[model samples]
Target: MVTVNEAKQKIIANTEVLTSMSMKPSESLNYVLFQDVRASISLPSFRQSSMDGYAVHDSDITARGTVLEILAEAKAGEGTMQVLPPGAAMRIFTGAPVPEGATAVIMQERTTRTGSFVTIEDFPVTPGRNIRSIGQQIMKGSIALPQNILLTAGAIGFLSGLNVEEVSVYRKPKIGLLVTGDELVQNGSSIRHGQVYESNSLMLRAALQQEGVTDVEVLYAKDDLRATIDALDELAGRNDIVLASGGISVGDYDFVGEALQSIRAETIFYKVRQKPGKPLLFARRKQTLFFALPGNPASSLVCYYEYVLPAIRKMSGRSDYFLRSVSMPIERGYSFDGERDEFLKATANQDVVIPLDGQESFALRSFAIANAIIYLTVNQNKVEAGDHVEVHLLPA
Candidate 1:
């Protein structure tokens, strides 16, 4: 078969982004924008007060003890405020519009007020200090958010302040899952002499859910070849993607590889150069993508991040969807040799890297809480404590 890179390219080349509705601005929290967003109106459309203070022209306040008469009182949400004449001041609360000819603001805390007249306690209170200018936060006719920007609490607040009600964003993908193995038993059930609890499927399902996938249909099939193929064929038509655990290895009950072969499916690659996921399978037909991950939990997670996420992104109309990792200073490093590129489980304490107990792909216990991977590139195998490496971030 082909290399991992070749398989990924094949999958990318064969798929297309289906047209889907984007989330509205009111509901865009935690979603990615599909396109740039432009402001319909300038933020802070009118000059406003930043604090409870007196609006006065800077030229009018020359020295300490200088006094001015309040022309009008302004409050929050009050209607059209009249402009103040030269040397005149207005009583303004927070968020109140600054009247015309007002060049600066004298905070109420700094001014000694008596009736309508107020005395300035501090001189040289600059203009624009207490006044928020028009479009100070955002400009009119300018892009508010760029394409592929992930919406957050701050983004929501910004959009809300701009009076945005709707926004365009990508939707998450829907996936179907299947687990085939007679050696597997459901949780809380008594296991037969040779059977074990079915853990891989649940682990994979949880991973998908963490990726924002909500529409998931899970199925469990026996080792029968016909039964397995029939189940896959039915799921293929119903879901945009399929994830099959087990039945892809070289054993007699491993019918997934043969079933795909029977249907003339395009098997991108049946093996990886990695340890636990060496027997991984990838195939696709029309728009329905399928990934036959190893029954091992750690291996399944590796392949999921490596391959499954890309498929979900493509189906969701996201262009730059891929796994991301952060780098930190390695606390310890070694020069080692290995055939396949290794992704070791690691814990990061700020800039220090600590390898998890088990780095093998079959060690789910060690991999479960892993947040980052220690990327050891192929071929050469040696690193120092300060080496910068690549890692695949696991779901928290």
Candidate 2:
């Protein structure tokens, strides 16, 4: 068995990012930036007032009880720009463009206004103190945002302020899911005595969606070598990635390996030094990719998030899109199977993440309240309280 580092390397080597696509900024939510954006015009474009106050020249705000004559009123989005003369002030509201030749703003509360004259209570107000200068937030021709930044709400807001209504980003890759089992039954149908719930496919679909995948199709195949092969052949190359669960182990009904080999899909890696997901397999053909995951619900979800999501992010044009978990302190010092790296179910509260019920893979209730997976490598499972561990959050 190879170490976790080897497995990670194998996974990274098989990844290839997809091409870029054009999209409206409105539809660009969750899309990755393809290129760095530079500002064309200065943010604000003109000096403006930041508060509801009076815009005045430098000489108008000097000495105690200095009096100034009001020239004109400056509303937020006024008609034409004007120049304020010396010893003159303009009644300006919030966000109003600061008239030319004016450098400071005094709040209405700090000055007494009567008729056309105003008296300053606080003398010697600092010039340009409350004015938002042109290009202050963002300069013309300056880098607005770097490439590969995820299109979040704040990023979208920045783009909107810059009047950019469209952008180029990498689209999400489509994936097809194939589940194979003879003892499995869909939830809607009545189950026979020997049958069990078929939940792995649904879990994997949800996990992929949580990773920002938009297109997914699921199909089930009866546990027969020929039938599984036929199903896979039907779905070949129709998806950017194919996720197959079950039929990877050395069982009588296992046939995914045989089918992949027959299809001539290049096998990059198979098996990893991890519990419950040690039977993972990865393959590629042309631009189409495939992954064979375990059938158990928890195992299926864990494996897909750990390996498949990274591949999806890379394909989405995000350079640093890998899942990063917070290194939260653990609650206890405990022992685990020292054979492979374990991603035990865990729950995070405040700053500490606690490991929940630890049971066999097939037991679904063990993960009822789990929000994260605590990482523990083989041969070093014991951890003291406050010792930080990597945590992968589950998609709710």
Candidate 3:
């Protein structure tokens, strides 16, 4: 069995970023940019008003009570082609184009209007006040967003402000999930003796979706060699990553490892020296990567977070593929007698982490409330109450 870090390195070495595709900026959320995005046009292409006020030349405001003739009204989206004459002002709304020769905007609330003339009441009248100049945000033909930036809502909005409708980004990998076990039943179905409600698929799918992986296909396979083989065969050709749950351990019904061999997939590693998911299997065939996770809900989810999520992030061209880790004090002491490294589910804040109960492979109740996973190395089995520990923070 390989160490967790070694297994992670192997998985990363085998994974490659997928091809890039041109998609609308709105549809490119969470995707990494393949190329630098340049602004087609300058943001605020023209001098714009930033408030509901009167646009005027600074020279026209001689004093606080200076009165100027109102030329015309300029509202948002309407062009004001006429230039402002000396001692003149234009009634302008927010986002309206500032007229030529205008130096400042006196907010309407600071002025009193009588007929075609308005008196400025504010004491200070500064030039360029309440105005957004051309290219203030982004200059035309300039790089608006650098390559490899993950497109978030703010990035999309900024790109949109630059008049960019589409962006070139690395495509997310297509994933196929095969859940194997005859004792597993779907939620809402009647359960008989020896039957368990299948939740790994649902949990894994939700986790994948949180990473912006939506092109996922899930299929069920009974605890039979032929059935598992068929499922693997079908998904291997159709997906870039195939994740199967259960049937990899040395049990009578465990056939996932055998099925991979039957299909001639190369096993990168069959197990990791970690608790809860010691029987994890990772393999590959050509461009397709495979992971056979333990069947227990907590074990499956833990393996997915530790291994599969990073692989997906790498394939999507992310620079930071692993979960955020930090060192914090443990609220209480804990002990493990085994040699394998353990990931204990815990609730954590900025200062400390509290290891929760129910650390068994099949237990997920504690995992549901856990915000972090405390990592305990095999070299040390016991921890003091206030000892500092490394914690992997779960995605919110």
Scored by TM-score, the top model is 3
How many pairs collide in each candidate, listed in order?
Answer: 5, 0, 0
For model 3 the TM-score comes to 0.95
lDDT of 3 by residue, 35-88 (tens): 999888998899999999999988778788998889898889894475888778
TM-score per model over all chains: 0.88, 0.91, 0.95
Question: Judged by lDDT against the true structure, how good is candidate 3?
Answer: 0.92
Encode model 1's per-residue lDDT on 109-144: one tens digit a residue.
Answer: 999989989898878878787889999988899899
lDDT (C-alpha, whole model) for all candidates: 0.79, 0.81, 0.92
| RMSD in Å for model 2 | 2.4
Q: Deviation in angstroms for 174 in model 1? A: 1.8
Candidate 1: how large is its RMSD? 2.8
Candidate 1, residue 79: the lDDT equals 83
When 1 and 2 are scored with lDDT, the better candidate is: 2
Top candidate (lDDT): 3
In candidate 3, position 335 carries an lDDT of: 88
Tens-place lDDT per residue, model 2, 119-199, is: 878677888878999999999899888888889888888888998867878878989889999999889999899998788
